[model samples]
Target: MNLFLDSFWRSVAYCLRPRVIALSFLPLVLMVALALGLGYYFWEGALDWVRGALESSSMVNNVWTWLQSAGAGSLKMVLAPLIVIFAVTPVIVVLSLLMVAILMTPALTLLVAERRFPQLERKRGGSMLMSLMWSLGSTGLALIAIVISVPLWLVPPLILVLPPLIWGWLTYRVMAFDALAEHASVEERREIFRRHRGWLLGIGVFCGYLGAAPSLIWASGALFAAAFVILVPLAIWIYTLVFALSSLWFAHYCLAALQALRTEKELAATTALAAALAPSQTTIDVQALPLPDDTTSDARPQS
Candidate 1:
């Protein structure tokens, strides 16, 4: 836990290198577009649902006066989406931070995999355009999950799990992180995930939960929503840096513990570990695993 936090700040220190710092805000920029565009489209549906739900329930009914006054009803219509974003602000913030963190990951992970590996090259492949596309791609996938799990909100659990992992994986792509990794594609990453599946997911779930914390209050008032817009970019930068550094540290720890080896070689890595350390370091220790995933669910209820 301490190591993750420490590594996160340290990664931030490195990411602020004159070059990467310029592009660090890329994810947040794309996210704003995603939030505005996605938010606009979803607001109508969310409002209808809220209105329908309010008609039958005593809970939201008390606010009917507030709901219909002037453009109040219209405002209420966007409330659900606004609230969702508001409650999940922390997660969103972390997600933004994840962008910057991902940018730094290639170099950071390189250092982890190979001692004194040179700093990763900062080439622009996944641009603001790419992240927007990433958001669109991921949002489409998440929307599908939402549809399949609707009414019962089974999707919340998945949301609690998926976002951070996706962010991490996206970092994998943009940061060229897997230069040291054995797996390349989603298939390979999944395979690597499977080999050390338990811990890998544990890390993802843990980070996602924490990442999703801001969303806990996402359903709150206008003030909170305003606060969220202000806080999101910075929060995300911090969140990504912290989560990525922590995750990479955890990954390194897992590699040390799990020893998920390929069939061909008993000694998996190249000159990675010292010859002296290699003999004693071969065995992985699971007991040293870090924290659990965050919240059980967002404020959304099961139907």
Candidate 2:
């Protein structure tokens, strides 16, 4: 608990660092550029397709009629755009997170290590290729989880609980491994992960919940299509910042746990060596006592 809270506060403080603030923008920029480029190319086509689908669907047509009857006909104009926005949102979020993980996590982890654990050894256990593979694999699984879980979303309680949990798990998996990749050996990383899995996952889950806040902007932006241009980028930036903070949080927690693991091992080794030498040292001291100089004592006893 102490460890968790300590890392949490440290991460929060680090996020305010100028370096971190600057680092966060890289992902944001990349996401914005990608979003804009795609928007420019596919904007009209996507809208046309969504409108055609909505118009052709019996269920949606009925809903449109009901909404018109209820005098909320204006909503129908935005419905297709809203659907498109929601559809694209998940992609933006995932890409932003991956960009931050790939581009920024190493630097953040290094910064945390240099500042807080200068003496910590770098085992270079995980390479960039391996980290990329791990991240992609985890992300793929998370996406699959989302797809499979969508049916359950109709259950309101499950809807609230499930997505964040999946995102949390994904965040935990990606961030924790990246956090320890440079400084901790494979064994050390696994050990720290096993020991601190719960706390790390809790951080991920909390950050996952925080990540959901941007959806409000997305929702609002969709409702007000006039503001879509501004809000979409704003939401992407928020996602980038959230992931950056999450990276820092995981970095602090994992690195601290790794440091403690090494310290504990060192202390154990020192104690074991002392224990192993104690009997030999006792014997040497006994032997060095010189048998009380029996000959000299005998010779002097007559006096």
Best by TM-score: 2
lDDT of each residue in 65-147, candidate 2, tens digit only? 99989999989888887888877877777888799999899999999999998988899999999999999999999999988
Task: Give the best candidate by lDDT.
Answer: 2
lDDT of 1 by residue, 1-303 (tens): 543354445544555555444444565577666665755687567657765775787666667666676557666555556655543453455446445444544445555555422232223333445445654555455445444544443467755445555544433333322332432333434455465455444455555555555444344433365765555455555455445544455445433332333332346444445676765665444445654655644455769
Deviating ranges (above 4 Å) for candidate 2: 285-303
Report lDDT (CA) for all predictions.
0.48, 0.89
RMSD of 1: 21.8
For model 1 the local lDDT of residue 8 reads 41
C-alpha-based local distance difference test score of model 2 = 0.89
Q: Which stretches of model 1 miss by more than 4 angstroms?
A: 1-23, 36-150, 153-194, 216-221, 225-228, 250-303
